[model samples]
Target: MGVIRLPSQSRLLCFAFHIIFILFQQTTAERELKFVVVVFRHGDRTPVVNFPTDLHKESEWPQGFGQLTKTGMQQLYELGQYMRKRYSNFLNSTYKRQEFYIQSTDYDRTIMSAQSCLSGLFPPTSSQTWNPELPWQPIPVHIVTKSSDRRLHFPLHDCPRFDELQNETQTSSEFQNRIQPYKDFLQTMAVNTGLELNNLRTLDNFQLWNTYDTLYCEGIHNYTLPVWATKDVMDKMEKLAELSLLSLFGLYETEEKSRLQGGVLMNTILKSIKQAVNSSRERKMEVYSAHDTTIGALQIALNIFNGKLPPYAACQFFELYQESSGRYSIEMHYRNDTSKDPYLLTLPGCTSSCPLEKFAELVSPMIAENWSKECGKKDKKKDIFIGFDVAVGLLFIFDLVLLYLLYHYGRCRRRNNYQDL
Candidate 1:
């Protein structure tokens, strides 16, 4: 065969193309995405509870209090679609149980949110379609009772140490100073909303967040705000609500508080990352359908919180990548605003693509080795209380038996006397 000669320009073009191809391959090999863990808040919903004096009632909502609204389902469905687009290349078109897992808090809103998200993420493929008319497939969303779900639920009510720390945080000079500006506003809110100022300030369950959240939800749905819930008042309420949330996870001894709250979820995520790195057939992604507090608690634990309530359908991503050097790195991203790209979050002491070891080390202090132990819970006391109750019951039984025997003996003696007479 005769060798064909090319012009100088043509030779140069070929050389450039060859180099580009080689570089693309090298780049692809250098950064391979291995696994992803996404934690997202439930979407918009009716207010959890109506204020005592508010015109809006729970009955007005299509679903009663705290259940997911149609709008909320749409928000999550859109979020799931976004996830599908974002991970199209990474995830299979068909739902594969071994390749993906999803869990949600055991609330009507969260469970429904997960289902909605899944419907968007994995519409039934032709082969998997059971109902041709309906474009959805059933994917189990694992859940535990809210009381027992320590991983996803935050501000754990059972953690006495957490409660103590929160109380201490409330009393700190910093907290007092922060709330000083909101005192008048809080009092005004108390008068208008029929909520006690003291409880609104101190109780996590009834914090100012509830009021702000109720108003926020109403405003979104175009309900006319009461005269007292003016623009300025709403703004102040938001600030106070944010402050209240921060106080729960931060404001004082942030690291210690996180260990008992958000750290539990962080621990689970870290374990999953480790498993993905070590296992051969690892799941591609794990989804957690939770609440705003869940995201807030996690970000606080990681020390990357943005100091605002996570908006409805907001999501946080933990992505694990293997570098060319045979080491894994983690990248965190927060997607709160739909208009903007997700914010890149760096571990305080490490770079955005933090090394696995470095990431683990930085987060270790926040991760509790034993949640109950760290929460200052003592099983011995429970055992002792149980023992005392058992002992008291046994003594009562013994007394009853003695009384019955005495009555029987006295009745027999009387009968014998009557017979002898």
Candidate 2:
């Protein structure tokens, strides 16, 4: 009312300030994440085999095929230490029993890896030292079995759907094309090994994949691989292993299928994080001990397949942080090789730091069902038989009545015939 008008620039500045203030307040009001879900590949192990006819096949390794090695235990222990250090801020000064959770596939190696990692993660404090002699405390590691298992663990045996997927994968155009050169290479190797190339496919067990994993793990642990196993050779083997994993679960053609493997896991992780953010529970770390196949499958499902496969002891981490302004953000860390710094992954639609809601939305399409509502329409023509037992009983009664009538009619006809005679 003072006939004086504010400058347009000043008015715009005031509006900007208001928006910034509101955003800042909103950011400050948001909560920090306390929950975490970790998914990891198992640690190192011995080569699954030497060669088909080689005397050392399956006997060279002390623990036999696909079992975890000492080196694998060490690798997981180191990973546990890394997790402890990285999440120190988020976790309590002492390990709060309730705040942590671990899940693994029900393989000896995976279960053992999870146990070993826990050993490194929460070493016994002085107070918890045992018997004034040894410093050991039992920590629980949860596992999901192939049957009734939601975690999608490996050596995923006995799944009909998974088997179908694998068959489709082997016959797919992409797989056939990719393996054509490898098929020739196998033929050459067959000549060298004196084993038939055709037999190689048929004779190979799941151990083929395990052999590749063990060798890669050993190489990482300073156990030099044979000259025959060059970086290129290992790379090819890793790809093959990944292909096997895709065969297990990544067979669907739609984006939803993509999301199911990738998005479902991601969603599970986010939900855990959200729960952590809201709850006062103590556990800040979640560990998932699994196989390289799990990593490959999840990556493929998420559409984030890095060129190389995730080797044994390879780890992927999702870190959540609260900024000064109070907004929450996320960072992804990946460690494939022991010598390198953890690689950072910037999720699509997510920044080096991403919002929780955005992260959920990104994977929602993958996890959400894609069936049409119209397709779910009920068939009115179909009888809704309540209590199948009762329906069966009624049918039995109707059958008895018909039988009784037939028997009486026959008797009556017989009596009439007797009278006529």
Candidate 3:
């Protein structure tokens, strides 16, 4: 070493290099993440409804209301194949029974759709055969029953706040503007079906809305709809249904419906991701098969409604990756068109893929408060409805009182007339 101490500049340069090296190493560690979560609508099925005058009704379909059609099966199978191809590298060479998990709403269509997906995703290969004679082994698809249903299931309860919101929305200037063009469409439907639009307006508050939902559900269940329902008509109906879902849960002022429904699903997914991250599990795909309403509500809650309505078999995906700098990024993908690559979603002040934590934080307010607690209370209330039967008993007493009053009034009038005579 030179008798002169190492220059201060050289020591400073060394310190700076060390810091840069540490940052580089940290960055390198973050970029190696691979995790994915997906929530998807069930494949096509029979319509939700069939108007009284419509030629195509529930009888047209072999499986009654809300059943999956053969076409739906084909659609899901194709989707499964697509997933297999897309994630071949991420998944095992052969489908590992334990590597992936699937859950669906406890409906026949959704259950079948999940099964169909599994069929296409992990077709029985020659190598997987424990016995040549029996090539297939049952892959479990978990479902929450209607009685014990959770996030991905049927019979979503009515939220009074959401109901109030819907009423407000019906009267809103925006809704009025949106429905103006559809008025002509409604009139045409009314004319063809012999349903008086004025009668509908007076008698049924949501006549048109109900009509569309019925058609939409019936279509998904494999029933043929009326000829009047062209692609454009069905498209419009889908939009209306989506609006209904948004009104149910996504509306800001109403009871936080999104939190109860989609918000719960999001929380579950996040919890799963966190678990995976902590456990360092290489397997990172989470799949949920649910109703169109689920997807619609989630999309609305996220404020990511693409103009086109999400059809049966629609899928929303969230991919999480850690960057080299130890930062996590999230990417949102939507598969509205099976043929095309999923469209990327962009969040304000963030890329389509933002940090997982940030994504949760953004949606936290929308999550319904005490959701699990409320759900528990609901179960208890449902039991009371059965045990007490107060609603039914009250109706019975009211009917009796009305009949008594009517009879007494008639007798009094007759006596008065007799006295006058």
Q: Pick the candidate with the highest lDDT.
A: 1
**Ordered list by TM-score, greatest first:** 1, 2, 3
**Overall lDDT per candidate, in order of appearance:** 0.90, 0.67, 0.71
> Can you write out model 2's per-residue Cα lDDT over 253-291, one digit (the tens) per residue?
535444434555665677777776677766677778887
Decide which is better by lDDT, 2 or 3: 3
Per-residue error (Å), model 2, residue 379: 20
In terms of lDDT, model 1 sits at 0.90
Specify the poorest-scoring 10-residue window by lDDT in model 1: 199-208
User: Taking the tens digit of each residue's C-alpha lDDT, what string does model 1 give over 1-421?
Assistant: 9999999999999999999999989978779889999999999898988888787988887777888888989999999999999889889988999899999989999999999999999999879999999999999999999878888987787888988888898889979899887777778888899888787766356557887888888899888779888889989888888887788898899999999999989999999999999988859999999988899899988989989999999999999999988899999999998888889999899999999999999999999889898888879889899999999999999999999999999999999999999
Reference-based TM-score, model 2: 0.73
What's the ranking of the predictions by lDDT, best on top?
A: 1, 3, 2
lDDT of 3 by residue, 1-421 (tens): 6587779999899999999999888776657647778788888777656566877656766777777888889888888888888788777756675578888888888999888887777777767756667534567898887777657652255444444555676666655665566676667778766677864332234455567767666565456667887789877766655555555454444326565566766667777877776785656677888877677767766778664556778988877787765667778889989779999997555667688778767777767667755444446677788768987998899999999999999999999999999
Residue 190's lDDT within candidate 1 is 83
Number of the candidate with higher TM-score, 1 or 3? 1
Question: What's model 1's lDDT at 333?
Answer: 92
Quote each prediction's TM-score: 0.86, 0.73, 0.71
Error of 3 at 343 (Å): 1.1
